[model samples]
Target: MSDAVQSVTIVEVGPRDGFQSVGPFIPTPHKIALIGRLHAAGLRRMETTSFVSPSALPQMADAAEIVAATDRLAGLDAQVLVPTARHAERAFAAGATHLSAVLSVSERHNMGNVRRTPMESVADYAQMVAMMPAGAAMRLNLATAFDCPHVGRIGADAVLALLDPLVAATADVEIALCDTTGRADPAQVRALFAAARDRFPEVRGWAFHGHDTYGLGAANVLAAWDVGIRVFDASVAGLGGCPFAPGATGNVATEDLVWMFDHMGVASGIDLDRLVDAARAVAELPGAQIGGRVRDALAARARKAAA
Candidate 1:
């Protein structure tokens, strides 16, 4: 790895994506507390919430309240996921400094998840990016970039083709390739990142959003890292699953990823002990279950040391 890749940015998506997957609504205060704990655990970048219709995702109905509650976290950059221009407006009003727009690479998955074709979603994203407040930054999350549950395998060329307009529109636009269905392999991950690096070299940053459905999220992360890709999207305690993607699992656990990076001599700037404690707290929430191996291992080690 080059000196330029000395550090990686871990975007904590637990409070939003993680909690959203846990079904039964988590109280607004509990969500706020989780974000607070994550901030205290050395996470600076976080996807705080999404401003989509509550009718669609009742779990995130408290988007406004969640954003308000997290206003006190000094030095934390809170981002909100927006599906449309209207959602972006709502997020801006709710005090979000960063906004992320999503478009799936697979047409079938895009229609299933966002109710639009991939092309239509990209058009919407371009419009949203154009209308974004000059002060706020916009990112595009290319969901199902690897392999789509509904559409089988997706080629790296297809992924780049979808990103063409977004890349041409904005030089610094960041794109996150989401393994929404967690079906991506290390080889696929390597190919996708390499394609992005080679084709869309102007892209500001490349992010990986992997799910543990196949239990290779961290391995894929390692593969991407070898090719100069940094900035990952992880949920605390492995919280998150796509309702549209059957048999999908939660994201790469933030605690588990941090532990992997720390042990591998890679720097993520996250405190594993504090992150594990946060994961335990999240696990105690109603309908929430802890989903990371490192968290469990750390707990066992701590108990043994105490004994």
Candidate 2:
């Protein structure tokens, strides 16, 4: 870890990203309660839900209700993913303080996932950013920033090119490099973050969304952390996968990351025990399986101590 990088922000995406991949639907109240528990655990940032069409992503059909029911932490910032302007409108109306949008660097994945070419999606994102409410913040997630499952081996230049228009637009936006298929390595993560930092100096915040497909998620995270990137995306109990990307798995686990940060002496302001309990509760939900080693290990330790 860099001496200059003292603390990192962990954005919990389990409620939205993690839960959406599971087959059966989680109840709206359950989702809200889960988020509430996360907030109580000292998590100040979370991705609550995605504002997508119900017919397309039935899992997220209750997005509006979840947002409305989630209790806002005093200083917490909540974000909702939006694929289009209409999604943004609904998300903003539903009381989301932050809006997240995605544009894949791979043309094929962009078209396949969002039904628009990469270029078209970029233009659409720019339009949405411009139309955002005055006080609302926005972030652009560059999905498949590393290797694309469909197109394979997306170059750093290609990733930077996609960011060009967004940079020029001069909107208040942050960029998160997403390992959509969980295929990124340490070298790829370093190179991408270095390239993004060099290209877009105005981009205030840098985040990484890594998948555990190859079990390189934590290693890649360490690589980014060494390079001054702080904000990271993780899911509770490791719940989530990309429906479009076959063989993909949930993101890096929130409890695992919190444990790592605690051991590293990095301040995350999150209570690991509370987060672990929340993860266990989430795991018990239908269609959700627990996925973090720390949570499981801690549970074992508790049982042994009791015995």
Candidate 3:
């Protein structure tokens, strides 16, 4: 409702999160092209790839190559999801200046996801944060912070507890509270974000990553935006989900989120037509599942206007 809410930041995660969900591997060139197109579409922060084991996530096997190829692109801040200190070092080795370290708030999900307890992962992440050089950027993505498939309803207090280890370590960090399976409600979203802001004033900014498993991804984004959250993680055409979590879908579609903000007169700084074109291209890639309403509706509207 205010002028400050008029502008926003969109973090393109299709190349990493979406592509990783696909069964077949997307070629490095396809990954690079999509990221390039996303950048041209006005996304500054993009998760290009992950430094996890290729055996585990074959889709991101080209992580090193992607960073090698795209790190120098003008105006694009390339980042990678690092699973450990070694992964973080490797990501930095591949010319990535921005790094994301994930820690799920749900102990059940954390054990299922990374085979570590929440505290164990926190200890590991502390080392990972220490390992990074001062100039390197970081974002702590708290997966299943809202709710987990294995354990439902992670309260705001538990989320703030997970933030304690990293909060004491640095003042230059950002947070991405993820609804890994898209079960997050708007009320809980507003509460958790507000709690995070109050508990960790050291956090530089906040972002939300939500899946559409429950069809609340877009609504959750708006909820977060209402509380002054400007950055978001999205996959073009709703292209991804957790490979480990059954029935999970993609993050809120980048195209749909852009359309939501644009209609509300908010400047997300994203090129809608170009983003839709990129989504269509991503849909053509091997093993991609496309389910974004905006892209399809835009196509229909174009035909209607032409008629």
What TM-score against the true fold does each predicted structure earn? 0.95, 0.94, 0.95
Tens digit per residue, CA lDDT, model 1, 107-168: 88778777998888777877787777778887788888888877788898898888887787
lDDT of 3 by residue, 112-174 (tens): 778999999888888887888768889889898988877788888888887887687666888
**Root-mean-square deviation of each candidate, in angstroms?**
1.9, 2.0, 1.7
Between candidates 1 and 3, the lDDT winner: 3
Give one digit per residue, the lDDT tens place, for model 2 in 184-235: 8999899889988987888778899988776787888999998889899999
Which residue pairs collide in model 1, if any?
Answer: 18-239
Whichever of 1 and 2 has more lDDT, that candidate is 2
Q: Which of the numbered candidates is closest to the native, going by highest TM-score?
A: 3
The TM-score, computed over Cα atoms with residue i paired to residue i, of candidate 2 is 0.94
What residue pairs clash in candidate 2, if any at all?
none
Off by over 4 Å in 1: 1-5, 242-248
The local distance difference test score of each candidate is: 0.83, 0.84, 0.85
Worst 10-residue lDDT window, candidate 1: 241-250
lDDT at residue 252 of model 1 (Cα atoms): 88
